[model samples]
Target: MSEPQHDVDPVRLGAYFALIEVSGLLRHAIEQQLQADGDLTFVRFQILRRLQLSPAGSRRMTDLADAIVFSRSGLTYQAGLLEKAGLVVRNRTPDDERGVTIAITDAGRALVDAVLPGHEAVVERLLFDRLSQDDARTLTDLLTPVRDHMRAAPPRSATPRRTRP
Candidate 1:
């Protein structure tokens, strides 16, 4: 329960402080708004939004998981909840019987359609409206590298080594 001790390095500390504050505030605002108006968890909202806009209104489970950044079971579980809520349906794909597909239900589409504008407004107020056009472009340029970095699979947690004779 000890506090994390740090040898202060101004450059690193400044970077860490800025990152934590910005990211924490952004996520807090997003989660609060999503809970208030979306009637769905962040992950469910993502899945439903994707399926609602997807061609043929469906996508393979693996692809959906990838796009939504959830583990396979994590996505599947959330999809199950949506199905129980009549928001999405799971069916076996004819092309790949082994793979499942998810499609948004009409009600799901309606739900997202109703919520999307509010979501957009929240996003605009939190981010876009605060920036000028030129600043937005510059922000996009600065963010692209960070986006690319996230797309790469992160390294797995390290395992401890045992000494050998």
Candidate 2:
């Protein structure tokens, strides 16, 4: 038997899936280039960039996790790998011995600075070059609401509410 055809929801059939598919493709492309430069992955790049922007090129471990939007454990693991690579170091807070800060080493900044031009080229080649100025502006406007709502989403442990009868 042949499959039946039905109306396609344009947003679902076209937009949403296309966005995710492009994201996967972009991730693969960038990761491939990054791996060639070294073993650095995109996630590690993000972490290093965040630290690069901070005081003395460092931030509290908790703050780094939040800034990178990675779970604490995930951030810790990534930091550990970067640490082993001598790209970062975990230091006990001088003021509060109980706390730790993640510092981007000189090598980390150097690596990111070196690789950024290549990464920027990939992004430009993949998406930006294909977009006209007007289209890029429109895309940014369309994404703002989704970005805000996601930023405001309830935490994972929130309780579900009951519907009224």
Clashes of each: 0, 0
Off by more than 4 A, model 1: 1-16, 154-165
lDDT measured at residue 135 in model 1 versus the true structure, 0 to 100: 94
TM-score of 1: 0.79
| Window of ten residues with lowest summed lDDT in model 1 | 154-163
Q: After superposition, how far is residue 149 of candidate 1 from its true place, in Å?
A: 3.2
Q: What tens digits encode model 1's per-residue C-alpha lDDT throughout 1-165?
A: 999997889997998798689778776776677788866777788898899889899998878877766777788889999999999999997976578999999999998887788778877887888889999999889878987786765322111123346
Query: What TM-score does prediction 2 earn?
Result: 0.81
Instruction: List lDDT for all candidates, in order.
Output: 0.80, 0.82
